[model samples]
Target: MHEGTALPGWTEMLVLAPLEWMELVGERLCVATCATVAYGAPSLGTPRPPAGMDYVRAYVLDSADTRELRALVEARIAGLADATGARELAGLTVRFRRLPPEDYASSWEKVWKPFRAGPFAVLRPSDRRALRATDVELRLEPGAVFGTGRHATTRLCLALLATRVARGERVLDAGTGTGLLAVAACKLGAGRALGFDIDPAAAPHALHLATQNGCADRTEWRTGGFEVLDAADAEFDGVLANIYSDILQAHAHELCERLRVGGWFVFSGVPDDHALATRAAFDAAGLRVETERTRGRWHAFAGRKPA
Candidate 1:
C-alpha cells in the first residue's frame, strides 16, 4: 500500500465463522496471506450476520499465484482449527472472488475529511477547507504508513509537541512513520528535524509528507533505525517516539542519551498494561516525567532530561 500507487485488482477471500472465533480466524488469515484482514461489522443499511456467525475477509493481488495462495489459506485455517479443537473451523472454507478495479486514488479524498490535533489542523492532500488564522495546517497522505494524527497516541504526541517544542530547536523523531511528528515539529518553529524508521518505504512517504506540508527544507528522513543517527556528537533539543512499549524499554538508554541535558521528549503507544514499566524505564534513563495523558487504553508521556 505504498503512496501514489494504482489500486490493483484483488482476489477477495471471505470466510464465515462463529463470533467467538472471528478474531482468531482473522489472525490466522492475516498470517496466511500476509495482508490486512477486515472483520465484518453491520452497517446502517446492512443486515447483521445469522445468530453468532460473522464474516472475515482478506485480500490478495489477483495474480498467477492466487490459486496457490488460496490453498495455503485453507491449509492454515484447518491447522488452526485442529490446534484449537474448533470443529466449525475445520469444516469452513474460503470463498474467493475477483474484485473489480475502481478509482481508489480518489476514494480516500471522498471519505477523509479534515481533523484537528490541539492547535494543528490535519488534512488530506485533496482537502482544501478553510481554517482559522492561527491554525497550523498539516497536509498529509497516510499511504499505509502510520501516524495520521487520528490515533490516540499520535494525537497525544502532537499535543505534547505543541506545548514543548521551542523556536530554533533541533528535533528527533524515532520510528517516524509517515513523518507526521517531525513535520509537525518543523511547523511548530523547530529549526530542524530528523526522522528515521526501520521500514524503507517509510522514508519516501515521510519525505512526501514533509514536502507537502512545506517543511521539506527543515526536515530530513532516513530509512533505518537509531543506528542511522550514529554520530557521537549528535544531540537534539526535543525527541519523539510513538513505538511499542517493549521497544521503548529496550532502547530507553540510547534514546535518552541522544537528548541534550534539559531537552524534552514525548513517548507514546504504551498500552495500559505496560504504562508503569515504560514509566520506570524512562525514569531509569533520567527522563523526569512531567506530564502523562491517557486516552482509551493507551498512555503518552511528556518529560525532560535531567541535568
Candidate 2:
C-alpha cells in the first residue's frame, strides 16, 4: 500500500505474513518491524489470510539491493515453512509494483501518520489527528536516513527529551538521523540545537526535517561525527546520541565532555543485553545515570554530567 507521487523507475514491494512471524522476519530482514500498523495511517485494505492465520504487512525499501533482498527473504520463508511443518506457508507471496516518480512523497504521507511517544506526537505535516493540549507535535517527512521517532531507540530518546529539556538550553545531537531529535529539541524550547551525522546524506534530510518543524533557524545540521564537537563552539546543555551500542561505548568520555556540568545526556540504540556495560562506560566517564527505559529488546539511558 504505497501512496506517493507518480514517480517513474521506483518500485515498492509488499510482504504479508502471519503476525506471529513478523518478529522473526524483522530480525532477519533488518528492516522495520510491523511497519504496516506502526503509524496511524488509515487501513488501505486487509488481505485475506488462510484459515486461522493472523496477517501483518511489511515493506522493503526500493534500493539497488532489492532483488537480492527478495531472494534472501524467500529463502528464509522456505526455511520457516519447513521448520513449522506448515507446508502451505512455503509459498509465501510478496507483491511488487512500480511507483510513478511524482508519487514518492505521497507514499511516505500514506504511512507516517500521527503517533504519540510519551508527551510528543510525531506526525507528517498533512496529518489531521487530534492532539492533546500538552502534546508536542513533531511534523516530519520520511527520509533516506533513519530516526523518524518510530524505532524504540528514538522513542526512548524523545521521552527523555520531553522530560529533561528545559527552556532555552543548547542541544547537541550526535549521529542525528533525519535530524528528528535536533528538531524535537528546538521545539522543546532549546535556544540552539546542533546535529551531526557520519552519513553525508543525513544532513540534508535532517535539515529538511528541521525546516518542516519550523525550527530551521534554531538548528544547525552538519555531516561528520564527534569532530563537530569543539570547545570553541561552546558546550551544550543537553546531548543526544541514538547510535549503536559500540559507538556510544567507544565515545562515552568525549560525549560526556560535550555537555556542560549538570547537563542532560541521552544515549540509546543499545540492545537490552548490553545495557549494563553501556551504562558502566558512561559511569566511568563521570556521567551519572538518572533514567533508564527499555522497549522490546532495546534500552535507552538518560544521565547527567556531575557538576
Candidate 3:
C-alpha cells in the first residue's frame, strides 16, 4: 500500500487527552472501535492540545452511518468519565474530519521508514529500494502498533530473539500484537508458531500479516490470553511476549509453563524501574534470567526455563 493514492470517504478522528489518560483512554478507544490508533507526545508545530496532552489518532471508514457511530463512541467515553469520578473528562471532545488517504499513508511512511531491529530489517512494502540481500526483511502493514517495530520494547525483544531463536524449533508468541515476533520466528526458520492475544481484533490482522510475509503456512493465530495455553501444549521450544510489567509478573509462571524444559522465553514492555521485580517474578517461575536489554525507559528479559 503505497502512500498518496486516492482513497475516498476515509476519516480520521483525532483525540488529544492528558498524557496519563493515554493508556486508559487509548485502550478503551481501541477496544471499542477496533481501529488503528497511534499515540505520541505533542510536539511543536503540531496543533497545541491542552498542556501535556498526548495525541491519539484513530482511522475509520467514512460512511453515512459514521456520524451515529461517532456519537455513540462519544457517549461511551463520557459515561466512562462519569463512572470513574472523572467528570472533567466530559469536557474532552473527539474531533472527526475527512482525511486524505495519501496524506495519512505518507505521514506514517515518513515516521515508519525501514529500520533494523536486531537481524531483521523491518520495512513497509513500499520500501523495496532499501532491501538488502543479507538481511531478513519483514514487510509490515502500516497504521497499527506492534506491526511497525517502532516501540523500544519491541526492538529489544527482536534483539533477544536474534540470539536465542533456533531453526526448526516451535514457538509461542503471547500477547502477539501484530504477530510480528511469530512471523519473524518462522522467517528465522522456526518450524511452526502460534500467536494469540487477548484482543480478538488482533488475530485476523496478525494472520493477514503472516500471509503477506509468506509465513501463513507456518503460523497459527488465535484470540485468547493465558487461558489459551494447556499443560499438554508445552511443546514450544521458545516463547515471546511484549506486554506490560504488571501483567508480565502476574502471568510469568503460566508463560514459562508453555515452554519446554530448557526452552527460551523473552519478555519486554517493562519500564526500567520495574526490571528487578519482573526478573524476580520470572526467576520464581522456574526460569533463570540469562540477559536483560534496555532501550530508554523500556526493558526486556531473556530467560531459560529449567531443565
Candidate 4:
C-alpha cells in the first residue's frame, strides 16, 4: 500500500481500424486489458479515414508473457494490417505503459494533478493536490477508471450534468463507477444526488469523494442493484448511468421509470458502435432522445420523459 514504481513490460501504441469493425482482438496472455485511450473512431463522419494504412502505435499487455503476446499479435493483428484493403479507420491509438512498482502511487498522483472541470477537482485531501478542477472537487484513490477525468463516458456525463443541474432537483446515479459523476451532480445544483452500484468496494471511495467535494451529507451512495432501488419508489429529476450498453438496455424500463414525470435522463459509457442498440432500447421503453454527442469511440445519449 506504500508508494512504488511502475512495471516495465506493458506496451502502448495507437491502433487504426475500419469504422465497420466491432470488437478487435486483445491479449489472452494478460488477466485484463485497460484502454488508456482509443482515439479517432467517432461513430458519425463522411470524411474517409487516412489511407496511410498504419496505426501509429498501440498499447497492449502481456504481463510475464510478452514474447507470446508479441507472437500472437504478429499472427493475428499483423495479418489484419495486411488485409487493410479497406480504408476508413486509420488513426486509432492506445498509448499504454506498464505499471512500474511505484507507478500506482506516483504517475497517478501526477496524472490527477491536472483534473480541472467546472467546480470539481479530484484530490487525495491528504496529498497537496492530486486533482484540481472547478469549485466542487472529488477525491478518488484512482481505481477502475484510472485518474477519473480521461474517459469518454466521464466527459459526456459531466457535460450533461453541468447543463441541467438545478436547485432542488433530486438526482440518481446508476452504475456510479468511481463516483465522479455523482459528486459532479452535487456541485452542479442538485439538492441531492444518490449513487448506486453492485460492487461494495466502490462505496468507501465514493463516500470519500463526496466528502472531499463537501457534498457528503447531500450525496448518498450504497451497494445494490436496481432491484433494491425499486423498493424506494421515489422519482428523481434526473438519472445518470454510465455503464455497459447491454446492462443499460436490460434496465431500460426501470431506469426510465425512476425518473419523475417530465424529468431528465443522462447516460454514457456507451461505445459509439453500440449507440444504435441503446437507441433501440430507449425507444422501446417509450423514451425520446433529446441530445447526443460522440467523441472517439464513446457516446452520450440523453432522453426526456414526455416533458
lDDT of all predictions, in order shown?
0.82, 0.75, 0.78, 0.65
Clashes of each: 0, 17, 1, 33
Instruction: For residue 298, give model 4's deviation from the true position in Å.
Output: 1.6
Instruction: Indicate the TM-score of model 2.
Output: 0.73
Off by over 4 Å in 2: 1-106, 128-130
Deviation in Å, model 2, residue 307 alpha carbon: 3.1
Q: Model 3, 205-295: lDDT tens per residue? A: 7888899899899988878988887766666899998988999999988887778899998899887557889999998989888898788
User: Which ten contiguous residues of candidate 4 have the minimum total lDDT?
Assistant: 22-31
**Which of candidates 1 and 4 reaches a greater lDDT?**
1
TM-score, structure 4 vs. true: 0.69
* TM per candidate: 0.75, 0.73, 0.70, 0.69
Backbone clash total, candidate 3: 1
Best by lDDT: 1
Residue 238, candidate 2: alpha-carbon lDDT? 93
Off by over 4 Å in 1: 1-106
lDDT of 1 by residue, 1-307 (tens): 4458666776667788787677567666764435455567422454677888888877666663366677888887778777887677778777777867855434533544578888899988777788999898999775656565677789989988899999999999999988999999999999999999998878898889988988899988989877898885389999999988998999999989999999999999887768999999999988899999987667999999999
